[model samples]
Target: MNLAGLIFVLVTHFLAGRGVMAMFGIKENKRKTLALSMIIGVVLFHFLPVVLEVCHIAITATSISIAIGILTLALFLPVSYKLDYSVLKITRPSFTLYEALFATLLILMVIPSVWLCYYFPVFARDVLSGPEPLAEYAVREHTLINSALSVDLTSTNNHLKPPFILGLQVIYKLLVHPFGELWLSIMVCSFLLMFYTLIRERVHALIVLFIMMLFIMMPEIYGYMYIVLSDYPNMVLFFLAFYYLGKYLETKQANTFYFATFLFCLASSIRSETVVLIGLIVPLLLFSFIKDRIKPGVIALRLGILLVIPYLLYYVWMNVFVANYMHIQFNTGEQLSVTSDSVNIFFDRIGIILGPMLFSEHARELFGYIFNIFLFTLALDLVLWRKKIGLQARVMLYGIVVVLVGLPLLGAIIPWFDINNTTKRGVFKLFPLAAFYMANSPTLLQLSQAIKRFEFPELTAQKNAAPVMAQQQKIKKKK
Candidate 1:
């Protein structure tokens, strides 16, 4: 039954994704289209229950299932009529022996992580205090329950946090009944698959697979995979937004732009802190249009509608509905004031927080080694190929720097919690992007090219020698 529910949910997302891709006329790249579709589908699925709740409709399992079914059919029908079935087929790519071995190694590494999601208990403290109670209340009550008003569970002051993941849990509970843990596994696996699909375009298949291993093996990343936390979901959404933005820059495709904007908004909705991505993304979009000598007004209008409007709506909704219900106030007086001591502490902890070293003893044991490896790779890439880095990569690097620097400043100003831990996890939100850019760095690309030259020197020589030999023969004939 658990397996059935998983399959059902996965298929529904795929179909809905394909429909979204078709609607946007995104047909150039198959893998990207499929990946973006799945992501958009998940976002829409999350929003469906919210819309129902807002309309004063009951959110029972049966109603949710029927709504999803109707949406799937509505989307699939037109897509089927318009798109050729062959476009959806997944053809296998031929691989060299080295590639095959690396691919196998990648798969082996991921299997343990996926298995851990199933075998390990859902034990993240934040999950128990945060999303779990919300999911339970929503599923049990057949409506969105006011956490502050509910007596059954303690509210964690996260009522304004987006409900996308909670809505997913509700659907999973309805479908699978009691097997809640399986849903966590499924969500984690889905993220891995999407990561692979997005990365394969920029890096070699072997390198892409290796990066996946690195991501899942990271203690911080895999720890949250099975836990009902918002961090992993926010990571996925941030990566998706940037992935599409990179695509838009490279291909100058409007559909990719639309997708990027949508994902950005969704990411901000998932985590308020992710609103910072707007500052990182808008400049890139403007640069793309200006570089292409395209009018910026059109880009500005589209962004205003797609990115700004959605963010504003979510902000207002959070303030009016969720915040009011939870008795939370959003005011300037609540801001944390900066002091000399706070500044000193922020500077002192900056190394542990933004650096690769894990500060917590338990987290250090689990994630220390993997985090150091990432740090080494990042340092190596920047030192060796700083000049060869592409503009898109440079933008991402700048964004990372801004995040690392800006977050500490925020922590200094607002001494709300342990600045060390806050900076550690907060900066972690940029890990996927950091790893991705590092993997596709010019140094890595040059290394891969050199490896190809060494492995197939004969092929390389034949191509180069052909032109020289032709010239020599021509001289001999002339003589």
Candidate 2:
């Protein structure tokens, strides 16, 4: 049954992704289109069913399946008619021996990580205190409702969470009756695949594979693989949002914007804290408008569709449905204060969070090797390929800084929050973006070039000489 559920999830997500890409007119790169589609599909899977249930529609397996079928056919038919399939064909990338070895090592790492997800227990305190119980309750009710009548297995705060993951769990439970470790396994593995797929599209296969290995090997990530936590899923969604945003900046493509907007909406739905992504995005969008000299009306319309509407919808859903219906306090006032002492405390808390990541032995044991490699490579990339860094890499770097630094500062200032416990988990949301940029550093390209030069110096020399020789020959012919 679990196997069937997994297969079902895979097929559903693929068709859904295909439909989304077709709707958005995204046909630039098949892999990217597929990745974006899967993300959209998953978000829709969780969102559509719950919204239907909320509107008093019966959400049976047949109804859900039929809706998906109609959606796929509706979007796909028109796009298929217009698409030039030959343009979608991507030639397979070749790799050197060193690249092959790195890819193999990463693949090996993925196997054990997937095994760990199945073997481990869902013991994270957050899981027990939050989404898991809510999921169980939703499954039992056969509909989603945030009311006092619901089972009180989890905290009031948990009930107030955006219902994306909980809704997903309900679907999983309904499909696979005895949902145990399989749901988590599916989530973790899907996350791994998404990260790999996105990275592979952007970077070389060898670099992407190495990045995946490092990401899965993170002690915090490995520890939480089986746990039903929002942190990892939030990270994946946020990274995808930023990644597509970066692509939009580079290519000025409408489809990338659509995909990025979809991802940002999905990310925002997972946790209230993910609303911080909006803080990052708004400034970038403004900058793009100015830089591109885009018309004001067009800018406003794009921003409205991408940022304003989605956030407004989430705001209403959370405040009206989740908070009011569940009788959960939407206590913004209690969480922040602007006194001098509070400002000092915030700085102190930032120090506390940074201390472990910067100096602690356990942190060293866990992240030291990867940290050093990333730092060294990043520095090299900046020095060697400053002009080539591109908007995406820069945005991702800024995001990491914001997560590592800004989040801790926010934790410190927030009067009611627990910095010690939440800071670590909060930082987990930045790992996917950090790992990707680290792997894509020009250092990898330089290293690959050096290896090629060492093995086949003549070929390397000829490649370099050809460009200069062509220019020289052209000059001579003109003279």
Segments of candidate 1 deviating more than 4 angstroms: 28-35, 74-80, 90-122, 146-148, 152-155, 177-183, 197-210, 283-296, 302-307, 323-352, 355-386, 412-422, 466-479
Q: lDDT tens string, model 1, 1-479?
A: 46676677778888887887777676746655555566666666777677667667788877888888888888877877888678657788767675577667757765775666556545656655655666677777777654524553433444445766666667777776442455455445566666666566666666665666666677776666655666667777777677667767777888888877777777777666566446655665676677788776886786686567556856765776566544556552365686668777667656656444454566565454544555676677779866777866765666566566556666666655454355556666667777777666786677667766877899989989999999999999999
- Candidate 2 residue-wise lDDT, 1-479, digit = tens: 56675677667776666766666766645545555556566666666555666667666555556665665666566666766667457789776675577657756765665565556545667665666666665555555653334555443365556766666666666565444445455555566656666666555555665677777777767766655667766777788788778878888987788778877777778766666546656776898888999999988888887767567757777666667545554765565766768667767767765676645887765554555566667888888897777666787887777677567556656654565556676767666777777755666756655755777899989999999999999999999
User: What shift in Å separates residue 225 of candidate 1 from its native position after superposition?
Assistant: 1.9
User: Could you tell me every candidate's TM-score relative to the true structure?
Assistant: 0.82, 0.84
Total backbone clashes of model 1?
A: 0
| CA lDDT of every candidate | 0.66, 0.66
Please report, as a residue range, the 10-residue window in candidate 2 with the lowest summed lDDT. 146-155
